[model samples]
Each structure stands twice: as C-alpha cells, then as structure tokens.
Target: MKEAEGEVPLSGGRITPDVVRVGNTVRRPVTAASEFVTELLGHLERQGFTGAPRHLGLDDSGRDIFSYLPGRVTPRFQTWSHDQVLAAGVLLRSFHEATRGSHLAEGHPVVCHNDPGPNNVVFRDDRPTALIDFDMAAPGHPLEDLGYMAWTWCASSKPQAPPARAQAAQVRILADAYGLNASDRAALIDAMLDRQARNADWWRQHLHAPDPRVASNDQILSRIAWSLREHDHTAAHRSVFEAALR
Candidate 1:
C-alpha cells in the first residue's frame, strides 16, 4: 500500500485538495463518501462503463486510489460547441442507463451525478469521453443531473456568454441528444430553473464563511451570481427554449 515515488500534485476543482498523481494512478484524500464512491466505480467497471475511472483501493496513507483518466477537462462555464453539447447529453444518458435498476439507485430512476459540469468532463479529440468526480453522486431523478448540466454547461452571466436564444437552442440540442421522453422534455426547463435557484441559495449561506472545500470566496460569489443570472436568463427565454424542444 505504499504510495509510489515521484508523486505529482494534480490541481483542479476546489473540494478535493492534496490530490497527487503517483505514476498512472491518482491518489485522493478519502472522504466520508469514499466507500460508496469506490463501490460505485466498481459497479461501473463491472457494467463495462469506461466513462468513469476504476477504483484501485487505498494508498498507504489511506487515500483513495483510482486509475487516472487520460483526457483534458474542459474549463467550467465556457461556451460549448453544438457537437460538444450533444455529446454531453449522450454521455449523461449512457451513464444513467448504466446505473438504472441497480441497487445503488435506491428505487429511483438512477444514481445522479448531481454535479456534471464541463469541469468534471474529460474530453479527447474534442469529444467528451469520460466523467470524473463522484463525491456528490447519489440516487435521484435523472433530470437532477441534466438540469444541473443545463445551467453549468449552457447558461452564463459573463459578458461574453451566449445569448439567451442561443443558450435555449443548445439546451434543446442537449435534450434531443439525450432522447428525452415527452414527459421529461416538458419538465426539463422547470428542473433547470429549480436547480439554479437551489444552487444560488446553497451559496448564499457560504458568503460570510466560505467552506474550505470551495476554491475561494470569490469563486463562491461568482457561482451564486451566475446561478441567479442563469435562472433569470432561462426564465426570460422560456418560450424560446420550449419552442426549440418542440
């Protein structure tokens, strides 16, 4: 269980710090959910889902070890190409289908990623190939992850962000790629809006005392502000989004 020599510090994302690359494997600090995540990864492996990393057990330091996925992670909140948007939807659906009907689903449709933003996605050849980070994974409605994706991958409050109509179109493309049923399609917008509001509210309490898990206070502020704007943006262009879905 000894950690290999020449450990390289891997930096990205805020919550999980002290991650190091030991050869071709990643060593991350074990969290309360580490056991569940490990089992989840194992399940994905058994199901032949290569979109996730393999759980390689713990290091000598008790850090969770996983086979390092090879690909560049997309920067968060950046504009996504139409193909990328479509690929994301397809990837998400595949992931959900992999977990559907599993005991881990806990009687729900599937275990939700809960946070499948661009930053968590690994891309190769300009196409999304994998998803990383499962600390927030839990059993829930599939729309929960899709809704979060809608906000994180499409909506933005930045000056150079896409227009509301364009964002709406991208959302429609994502839904189409996922091949949502009529009922799910009708509920997509509301789910996205609800996720936005919850995200903003979740950050509001952290304004005064930011969690050590987050990257920075300013980053938190940025997220809260972005979520609020995204909510408003989606709401303002609800008609456009609905039309595109049709």
Candidate 2:
C-alpha cells in the first residue's frame, strides 16, 4: 500500500486511508474493514457496478487498499442546486438499479452505502461521479436510500423543515428528474419524511462518539428531527412535496 494518511476521524468509525500503488495505478483504504470490505468489493464488482472503489487484498500493514476513483467530492455544507439535484437523482437511480436482487449472506446482509449525501458523492463536470464511506452502510433498503437522500438533499437537511416554496421548487425537480410518478410522487415524499424521523431517533440512540464530527452530526440530526416533529411533517411538507407532483 502507499503512504498512510493516518485515520480520518469521523463519527461512526475511523477511516484509516492507506494509499497503495500497483504499477501506475494508485488506490487507498486498505484493511479498514479488511475482510468485510474485501468481500463487499467483490460483490459490487460481480454486480457490474464499477462506480465504487475496488477492494484490494491486504497490504503489508494488513490494511486493505481500495481503488481511488477520481472526481470532485461534493461538500456536506451547501445549498441545493438544480443541476446537482438532478445529478443526485440520476446517480441514486443508477445505484439502486445496480444493486437489484443482490442478497447478502445469512448473517451478513448486503449493506449498501447508507450515506450518499453530497459529501458522500463524487462529482465530475457538475454531475454525481461515485460514492464514498460505508461505515453504517449495512442491510439497507432501496426505498430507504431514496428517502434518506431526499431528506438530506430535497428537504435541505430535514424533511419536515424543508426550504421555502421557491427553493423547494428546485428540490421537487430532483424527484421529477428521477421520474417519480403520481402515486410514487406522493408516497416518496412521506416516505422520505418518515425515514428522516426514524433516522434521527436511530442516530440519537446509536451515536455516542467522542469525535467532534460525530457530535455535530448528532446535533444537526437532533435539530432536524425536532423541527419536523414540532411542525408535524405531513402538514409542513405537504405543499412542498405536492408541488413537485404538479
């Protein structure tokens, strides 16, 4: 493996990036989740999804060196964009299509990369490029991914407390770009809100990390949940969610 960038201290787990160079090609993330990641990589490869990084075998340091894909990494902190939203919609559709019918082992359900938020997305030419981070990416549901992504991007960090009407127009454009039909359009909105509510409670119970990043995520998640519950999500996002269906 190549040089170690030490551990990227995040909330869920420390992503220790170890760069490796095989011939002219360079890759990173060796042995971080060694066996699990190695196996996951194989599965993604077999499924014909080449967008994700390849999981290389263990290195001298016993770390797994994953392939390093090239693209612009979207920031976690940013306002929604029409193009970005469209790109996100398309990328998610692709990811979902790629993961169809892939079942995990008895004990190990195929965990999708749960967080494909802006930070998790890699962009090239103002479009989504690839996915990163898989800490809590386990035994996921495709619709759940849709909900999670919509909550973050469409609702602007919260489903109940989405952006104002003008901005929300752009948000609705995201789902439209993904081709949500009439029934799906209505259902997906509520599904996303429900997922946000559920995720907040889940994270509150599970996230007890010492890292500041984790702490911040917990705080934001708490706020998002609180805002949604305080206003009653159905009432709050009904218009915004419905506008897109129009």
Candidate 3:
C-alpha cells in the first residue's frame, strides 16, 4: 500500500483523506474497497439524502473521490446548553428521518457511522451540516446510533474539561428531538455502556495501524469501557431521555 501523503484527521473514524479533486485521485478498479464504495455511492444516490458526500468516480491515481461538505465540526464534550442541545438533537432527528429506509445489502447490513465522536460531525453557522468518514460504518445495529451520538457528543470525557450542565442538557434535548419512545430509552441507557465494551476489542487492532497518533487506542477504548460499566449515567439518562421528552 502506498503511504498516504497527508491524512486529514477525522475524529474516531479512519480514511486516508476522503476528499480529493474529482479528476486528480486514482483508484484500484476491482478491489473490494473500490467495489464497496461504488455500491454505497449507488445506494446513497438512489436514496437521495443530501447530507452525505456526492460520489464521483475514479481519478488518475485510481483513488475514489467524494465531494466534500464543509462546516464547523463539533468536538465531543458535554458543554452544550439546553438550547444548543435541542437544536443538535433536532438536526440528528432530521438527518435520520430524511435518510431512513436506506437498506443495506443483504448479509452486509447497515451501520450508521459508528463513531459518534464529536469531531466527525460537521457544524456550520452553529448547526450540524454533514456527517463525514464512513470508515467505521459496517453491518450493525442502528438502534444505538442516536444513543451513541448522544453519549459521544454530550459526554465530555475528553482531555479538555467539559462545561458544567452540558451532559444533562444534551441527554434531554436528544430524547426530545429524537422522539425516542419507551423502548428506545430502555436500550439507549445500556447501549451507552455496551457499545464501549464492544469498541474495546475493535480499538486494540485499530491502534497497530500506521496512524501512530492513536497509539493509545486500547487505553482509550478501555477507559470508555470502564466508564460505561462503572458510571451508568442512568440518572441523567432518565432525567433527559425520559422526563424531558414527556
């Protein structure tokens, strides 16, 4: 594999710079990666959701090209006030609504971008515009997608200190915006924990890759796991996801 010249960083997802001018990049015609991209692009085109990248075919280097959507990307933290949280929740709801029923290939399944990491989300003029980097997207449960997003975007466990009362507002706004029903809330509280445990195994392998910046992936994964297990955040979960929504 030729080394990627300069990787544009996306939070908690992997791709060697997803965007390049349509004519400049090159691609391997018959590879699995190539085929998968083609298929996904086709699917999204048919679905006609405007939030994701518009797929342009291969370029000189045989690499895939996707039109970039520009916006302010939100970093993971629990600092958002109730107002911001509500708006973000509403946006997520709208995205899912617009893109729902996009069935994945049989046996392949569908996973919404698994990394709800705040930076992976792009916000422009104070609202989330587009979601980028599908590296971790795979066959899985989307039921947890909103919960994962809520946890990652609003949890505020980053190295940087999170703002006070952010977590509470985030959870409340998300539940209200998503219109999460009784069943949804039941799953989300636990999904927050279970997802981290699952990711712990996934990150161990991810750390060995050439992206040395994520060398502590295992540690990071484990820490999330510990937090999930030890700290249920259920009180906040119920307060926001349950009471606020009702």
Best by lDDT: 1
Error of 2 at 22 (Å): 11
Error of 2 at 216 (Å): 7.5
Residues 22-76 of candidate 3: C-alpha lDDT, one tens digit per residue? 2333222234455555665566667665666665776566666666666666543
Task: Specify the highest-TM-score model's number.
Answer: 1
* Model 1 accuracy (lDDT, Cα): 0.86
What are the per-residue Cα lDDT tens digits for candidate 1 across 1-246? 333569887765556787788888988989888988998999999999989989998888888999988878765558989999999999999999999999999999999988898888889998888999899899999899989988787766666887778888888889989989899989999999999999898877777674464546788898788789878888887887788777
lDDT: worst 10-residue window of model 2: 9-18
Residue 129 of model 3, lDDT score: 61
Which candidate order results from sorting by lDDT in descending order? 1, 2, 3
Which segments of model 2 are wrong by more than 4 Å? 1-36, 105-112, 157-163, 206-235
Which of 2 and 3 is the better model by TM-score? Answer: 2
- What is the Cα-based lDDT of residue 230 in candidate 1? 79
List runs of model 3 lying over 4 Å from the truth: 1-34, 74-78, 105-111, 157-166, 207-246
Return the lDDT, model 2, position 28: 47
Candidate 1 TM-score versus the reference: 0.93
| Whole-model lDDT per candidate | 0.86, 0.60, 0.55
Report the error of model 1 at residue 80, Å. 1.1
TM-score of 2: 0.70
